[model samples]
Target: MKEIAQSENIEQFSLKNYIYIDKTEYIYNLIKKYDRVFFSRPRRFGKSLTINTIGTLFEKGVEPYFKGTWIYDKWTQNTCPVLHLSFLKFSVSDLDNFKRDFCNEILKFAKTNNITDFTDDKEPKVLIGNIFSAMPEDMHIVLLIDEYDCQLTANINNKELYEKFRLFIREFYAVLKGEKHIRFMALTGVTRLKDVSIFSVGSDIKDLSYDHAYSQMIGFTREEIKKFYIDYLKLGISYEKHIKTDCVTDNDIEEFLDRMAEHYDSYCFDEIYENKVFSTYSVNCFLQSISQNQRVIFGDYWYEAGGIPSILKNYMESHEIEIDKFQTSEISINYDDFMNPTSLPYMNENVLMCQTGYLTLKSEIKPPRRIKLGSANREVKAALNSLLSQKFFNPDALDSFYDADSILEKGSVEEIIEHLNKVLATIPYDKYPVENESILRALLLMYLSGLRCDVRSEQHNFKGSSDLLVNFKTRRVIIELKFSKDGKDTDTLLKAAQEQIRRREYGIEKLGDRELLQIAAVFDGSPNMRKITEFKQIG
Candidate 1:
């Protein structure tokens, strides 16, 4: 922790300290194998850092900067001309301004490399060609572009503007189609447009976004955490008031890792699903915060760091995306279709969510190129729930929502029922249509997820499934919901729900010495009334 300072400049920090893990061998192998590579990952997932690392390696050979890295002894190639471009701060509001600025950026890079055979051309495509032509014939150049799709994603809502920009980008990138002097090239972005010229043209760029070999290249793996940040983990545990310092054991550290994984880990990018990594940005932020404050705190650091991508926020608002559907059921889509989206304007909401990091692959690649997607982790789920609740429900009313952790720990069944009723009353009538028990369960799950508890829907056992289950510390609440649009009485519905929970033996095996609370709730699903009518404890 002392070696790592809080700095936004990752390049400088990485070069100066041992805090950064070395992945030079992996990247070097990729460069040696592929001439052109395209990668896609969510925002703030170290794409920029990866680009910079490659740029530095090619521009300055691994003498002083990468002295002890894996590639130091094996980098046999001489340093060559490197052209690095980053679109993270590009202004794309106007086409004319964008063109002028883009050309200037290329010219700036060209001038730094002492390639001065450039005409005063405003066209970016011409400037790029001139730069390439001016380079020495024997020396091949390495090109690294970060956030290549930033312009298109920014203007996705404006169809006319987006099309115009897309045409310009396609033509501009088409200049690299037959560049024989390119030693290696790589482009990284949040989404990979299917028909874009960068992929559709003659350029043989391999998309390594879902390649299992590189899935753990950017993010921090669990083993990496244990190897690099074990001291910080112990520090966090020491800061925990409930854990005594003298009695700290290996089990305490394992439990702390589990809690941290719930909030920040479990992001599966590839189909294999064998290796899941935590968001690098989120893990760094958490460690930095705890180090500064001397306390253990788990927050939505990733979501809070970048809020939500404007593209995703706009898409969710414009489309009638059923947020509950993703929570209630497994969302499976073709792997090819999900990876190579045709266009951003008409892209599927699930694809957009997956690209933007709200959702991630939940299962391995199944038959027929199908994969299941869900919320990346608990932090992501809580962030989405908070966003939707703020958008639809009254903010002030949300403050009145029960303290979920406290109530689940010590409150009685009647208190839990009252909490559920209060939470349901905040939902607007038209926003949520309680048509069936599943819908009701999904809605409750969505709202309850925002609290500090492990809330799940459709908990299955050997016999059947329970509607909802909420676990907080030492207490677990298993809820069975019954919805009735016809003329079914609350008493009958409650009895049926209780019978189902008992007959299914829900929570019997899972309840290992912890106190369990079973609830039976009946909701009135009529058009005029969509609230939980009555609820009581079944066991």
Candidate 2:
């Protein structure tokens, strides 16, 4: 064993330097049952490391790395002729180049086994069979492929080009089927390319993506945190002394853990067991921040390093969905709906969000079959909030929204509308088409929620629902929104809006003694143009 340092950087991610979380034993045991396996997980969730671990365990002359781990003692000398490849290492400009590079990679593996009968003129898809033929009859080949769908994800927006790449890759992967010479084959990637028709051939290939047994494979469980991170806990003292300039205590350490979990944990994949797991990338990033700054710093490091996927941004805007609604709505998608891919501009936003790691599975329903989803954690929420604020709300609108806190504090509905109209006026003309009153409502709802205000849209009350319900510590605001076509009287629309709120008695049941501010707003325009007709303090 190497001399252990009093404080080691958890961000040092090599297996030799990294603290082994013991998932390798579980993974090795579970994976041995299947000859061909496919596992998909979000990026930076430790897919590469897991692939590396598996390769190390199976390949010859790599026993030194596993010296301290469970796989070291429990297993016999079980080595195989391993052929490892990662798509990250290859970038091709055209189909011919891709084919050439692919064949060369496979041929390189064959040469290592001291078999060199394959020619450069051979097709890449059939190259695997040639490699299989060249190997000794007694030996079986172990094939490990990492980031199998990297090219497709990298060019997701270019559907025309991506389709070509997908077709070629799918055909190549299809070659793995019925290959008796293969001892084990595993492919790992961030996404499952369901449309590609790659894994359709084999019932033997296990998709451990959502399996409960492997949920803890790619990331940290709470138990793993306590077991592996005990030494780094004391780094809080160094943080307090050097950075925070405050006293550090055991309570602070506990608080740090809680905050860490809140920001980066709570990603659930399995339907039967909704196990919360931390994103290994974010955890390492957090630990690295603490080590470098000698203090705890909360950030969207994952988002910072890897921004929101462009596909997600395009989906929200094209659907004309309110950014706030996209953030908060109770989205449910059937299993088929979640897995199947439609064309761009028509893709299911909920599925895209869930698969991309922004949203985590919340619950599963059977018989009609649906999955409920919400933001994975505070990090995701923060990233979305920042994206929404940037894409939709301008500084003037944001200022007006913040001013609403004080406007509501004074129980003045008219003043609140004045602030809101300021926000409305500042909205960029190209923000959204604002085709109808619904879009207008969505704007306000999204903005208010983004500000971290307790705002609900279409919240049901005793008699009916309020368009917007703003909650405060000791008060509540009930708002009714109305829209009119051009030439409609602004005063009449405002009166009708007020009448609806009064008729519903939105706050009668719950606003005892606490301030109840009733508001009404009216707007007029076609989808192309809109202006506020009236805003008033109804009560």
**Among all candidates shown, the one with the greatest lDDT:** 1
lDDT of 1 by residue, 1-539 (tens): 44543333345765667477666767888888888998888988888878887887788877677776788798888888788878766776788888888888888888887887667688888889887887788868898888988888888878888897888878877888769888889999988786577766355888888788888887888778777777788778888855555566788878988888988998887768777889888888888777789898787887787776788776656666675666744688777677557888888778887887878888886556687888878888887776565544554675657476787678998877777777777767676556677667766787777654678778777898778888766888898888888636878988888888888877776677778888888888776666777787865
TM-score of each: 0.89, 0.74
Clashing pairs in 2: none
> Which residue ranges in model 2 land beyond 4 Å of their true spot?
1-16, 60-62, 199-203, 237-254, 310-325, 340-346, 365-367, 385-539
Per-prediction CA RMSD (Å):
3.2, 6.4
Q: How far is candidate 1 from the true structure (C-alpha RMSD, Å)?
A: 3.2
Residue 202 of model 1 has an lDDT of 56
